[model samples]
Target chain A: MSKNLHTSAPDTDTAIDRNVPEFPVAQDSDEQNYFKTNQPPSYLDQLHKSTKEFIQFHKDQGKGRKVVLVTSGGTTVPLENNTVRFIDNFSAGTRGATSAEYFLENGYAVIFLHREFSLLPYSRHYSHTTNCFLDYMTEINGELRIDPKYSETMHKVYKKYNDARDQNLLLLLPFTTVNQYLFSLREISKLLNLVGGRALFYLAAAVSDFFLPHSKLPEHKIQAQDHNGGKLVVNLDPVPKFLRRLVDSWAPGSLITSFKLETDKSILIKKSNQALDRYNHQLVIGNLLQTRKKEVVFVTKDPKIEPEWFRLSDEEVEKGVDIESLIIPAVIKVHEDWIKNHE
Target chain B: MSKNLHTSAPDTDTAIDRNVPEFPVAQDSDEQNYFKTNQPPSYLDQLHKSTKEFIQFHKDQGKGRKVVLVTSGGTTVPLENNTVRFIDNFSAGTRGATSAEYFLENGYAVIFLHREFSLLPYSRHYSHTTNCFLDYMTEINGELRIDPKYSETMHKVYKKYNDARDQNLLLLLPFTTVNQYLFSLREISKLLNLVGGRALFYLAAAVSDFFLPHSKLPEHKIQAQDHNGGKLVVNLDPVPKFLRRLVDSWAPGSLITSFKLETDKSILIKKSNQALDRYNHQLVIGNLLQTRKKEVVFVTKDPKIEPEWFRLSDEEVEKGVDIESLIIPAVIKVHEDWIKNHE
Candidate 1:
């Protein structure tokens, strides 16, 4: 349990733990109740048909290459049915968007399930930064052209984005609420299973841990004065552990990689290890909130194997090297190994 | 009190109500205590310096032209000091940003106090729409240029945005939490007082009605199982009514227009009139949640005067006529009349 990064394990030859912990039977009914009680996303029919087409197109285009389902952004938990207010997680989805680009570059088709208005794979390169989108444009002689300072980078990003669209390597789906996110995830997991173990699930979205059934919420906006002494109180139930169902029943024999984000760095690796043990997943990428943009530690199943840290050098960071460029490659390596082992 | 739009009243000659309701002295100490307890934003010094400079620059640029402080987007109620989760209002800043542009077009310098990363006045013409920002760009012979389909509109937007920046007619200041927004509003209201009766306050931001003092929230993320029956319960106090303070002392004699949004249409006009009566502000722009983008009602003092509706016809909407185009001009007319009457 050495917490130091890049430490070599003395017992590298220790066999990996193959035991699957018994599924949390107590929560299975709770999860089932969640799905039975909640309504599905509005555009689910279209999402399903389009996703099938995307997977089939790539399958016909190439036989043995991998496919990744990348979930990004933060899902909302609405406080009321009419939804004047909601609890939201603060995430810009930089990790998921950047990782999708790397996955596409690595020749894997990507299904990007993201929060509706959060960042996207290529468009994120321009918008939502310090400069406004209009800053890139200029009117010269009645023609609208990008400023010279940005044209080169814009061209490269646009070229890759265009390729992804034209070659059928990417599919974009948007979800707003945690309810929609969970339901879509369950359905998409079944669709991704068509590819067998060759599929990789990159669960990066900041899914809420707490939620309320639709019946529990007020029919209209909460009145501030009607509550206790002009105060508001919210009672929320825990969203069932859907990851267990995701790993156990929905996408059987698939490679699932989840992210563990912690504010305290002291317990980051330990919790990541626990997640792997509990869910029996392939990998857990552990990151601290403070240094997540620059570094991450990979936590695998074997207790004897010291967790490997991936980091961007200060020089590389200054040069604008994205850490996702490294994490994606590491993930693909294990994913490919899993595919080969399953075969 | 007919709810129908554009209904005219026979009592047109009735004198506008000059009676000011006695101020709620009870909440004055409550507001002061709240301000004393909450921390100001991190960038207070920079924001203060820039805002002062912006007001002075606009003053020297013109003698009698009115200046507007436009607050846009929605504020957050952070659940924790570190802020992993929070309550958020669902606002895209469409109403605020769109109105700011019209304000500028009417020859007024605008200080846009907005939520960080929300839509902006000129840049909003292209970004945050259904299409991605990259969709507007085309790679032509290794040059990044505007796509032909969007060039005309892009050029128009770029020209206006460029003009605003070059003339110092727009100053952008950003805030995230309700704490920062309230603090900034109080500070900016003081500075705006320098312009005397010429300053107009357009309070359009969807500030949170409920908030919690930092001392009340847990220091870390709320763990699910640690709570009763795996549920989370949050208690939040109502944000103090700052509009009363804004009218009586902060910017005395200024023309203040505040927006009142309601989901229940039956109560919309009644609440708007009550707000005007309670705050003694010049105008209350009342809007329904469903039809706000297309229509609004102007609620002034003298309940005898019927509310006047501003709307966009179907043909006008089809031709892309922004409702703000109509609303802003009407607002300007009332503002101008208010200035003349005060003189």
Candidate 2:
């Protein structure tokens, strides 16, 4: 048996961070160097302008224009620069999209940062994975009309969507790779931070924890040709936990809420605690992979506070009710308290 | 560099194939053994039943019914059992989806085996990535109707979709993992095989060329904990080319058309020709990654035939015409010739 191995030398990555001074977040060595080394997304400037416009729109509406940055969907980690293939996390952005709608209903302007082609706020009612959009409309009297079966729910959704658009309360932005997501997160955090306690960071996106640096990535698509029974080996560096920077510097004075997803039951609360302790973020929502849609546990930064559980009943599940309906209002209360404390 | 190398020995896969008789594609050893080593998709039986019913529907209708299996979108290769991360190919199934619409229009029954949430035939008009459905609709006197801007085109698409449903001319089935796709392809191929030359195999799906065998995958999500600044390594085995088995056994008398996508212009035709030589399939369509939407070259199995270029003009591009509208007709013509020659 012949063996062919594809690998990268890790000695280069570990050698130390000697020259990291260009960006802020200087205390975190790896994350600070990440920006210096990697190229920002192509549309970073446009994204910044749009974000500023969203905040300014709220400011013009007079006092108490609370804005929430809703980061949704999963980020991909490309193995090659040309990217015929990439490592993707299992997420459809249901949590963030659902929460964004609820936030809007509660009169909070939303900045929806999402993965391309994942579910969105109003459109989630008629998702792409389910029945085709055409199925919901029937031709009658030379005009297409909404099917009576779906008209009631869709009409309500359509009205809400119109109100959102008319009020300019929703800003939709897309990111594909982990780098794009990270860079945009920084820009958004900085923009929202200026709004101070009026801003809230609802970080629900399923960010990849590992990524392959540009230096190691192949220029073209990885060839699948067998080299005497070959194996394609991919070495990925740990994606620096930028939540630290978000809590400490990026979005200071804002209520930062993040998620902790675990497959193991015993380690769920423990891991959530570690994140809260490490970043001292306002809240860490802990949920297991299998039951995330129905249940979640909130672990707060206050050491004396106990974890709180939130769940939906079987009847709610049968009725196709989203658990986010409960989750967002509770977070709003916490955010309200946060603003009061800071004031 | 303190390298924490994660690897698997290749001696395990390199040994001579044993116990491959159970599968019919035993003429090719690796593909036959692939089925033995891997578990069939959980829904394989249901998929088989559904596919058979589609074919039987055409048979029960009348004579001279031509059926085409249109496989679309990209298949994912899971890196772990719990599958927090997966290797995904970049495809939205535009070609296959667009071509299926054309096929149904040309009086052919289509079995659309597509990736979950990918673009569909009529639904491609309202893709999830493009615009929210609510954006395409309007309320007039408390009644929601298709927006006038999109009304004309959408009405046409809607009528065509209703025709498809009334006639039962289209069957839509979805696959996620590459294994599920492969298993379903084999079953669909055999079902279509009995129709002989009247059946056409349009293999447009972007299947992964490499996969991780279950023997090596981790049970849970790959942890991002830095082991002294650790690098995560993944080894993938080359996926065995199943075209050989598909042509020779699975769909013996069907017209097999496949696609070759390349980023490098220099190697495109040469590699495509190599595949033609290896598989002896009826046709291979070669296109570069950037130009796939506009231009493609048809490489036939016959050496005497020159490579044919089929491209849309700049005017056509400006008018928003799909290249598949042209490609599918040409393919249908080729299939017609194939059927006549066999007769």
Strongest candidate by DockQ: 2
Model 1 segments more than 4 A misplaced = A1-26, A225-228, B1-26, B225-228
Report the alpha-carbon TM-score of model 1 versus the true structure.
0.91
Query: Could you estimate the TM-score for every candidate?
Result: 0.91, 0.91
lDDT tens readout by residue for model 1, B115-143: 98899999987777778788877766767
- Residue runs of model 2 more than 4 Å from their true location after superposition: A1-27, A224-226, B1-27, B224-226
Candidate 2 per-residue lDDT over residues B1-343, each given as its tens digit? 1111212222323211111111112246678778888889888899889889889878777387999999999999987788767889888889899999999999999999999999899988787546787898899888877789988888889999999989999999999999888888988999997788899999999998768776666666544332243445566666777888888888889999999988887767776887787787889999887889999999997879999999999999889899988898999999999999998
Q: Given candidate 1, what's the lDDT at residue B40?
A: 84
lDDT of 2 at A41: 92
Model 2: lDDT of residue B247? 85
Question: Model 1: how many Å of interface RMSD?
Answer: 14.7
Displacement of residue A343 (Cα, Å) in model 1 is: 1.1
In the range A1-343, model 2's lDDT, one tens digit per residue, is 0011112223322212112111112257788789988999989999999999889878777367899999988999987777777889888889989999999999999999999988899988798546887889897888877888888888899999999999899999999999999999999999997789999999999998778776666666544332243445566676777887888888879999999888878778877887776777889999988899999999997768899999999999999899999899999999999999998
**What local lDDT does model 2 show for residue A221?**
55
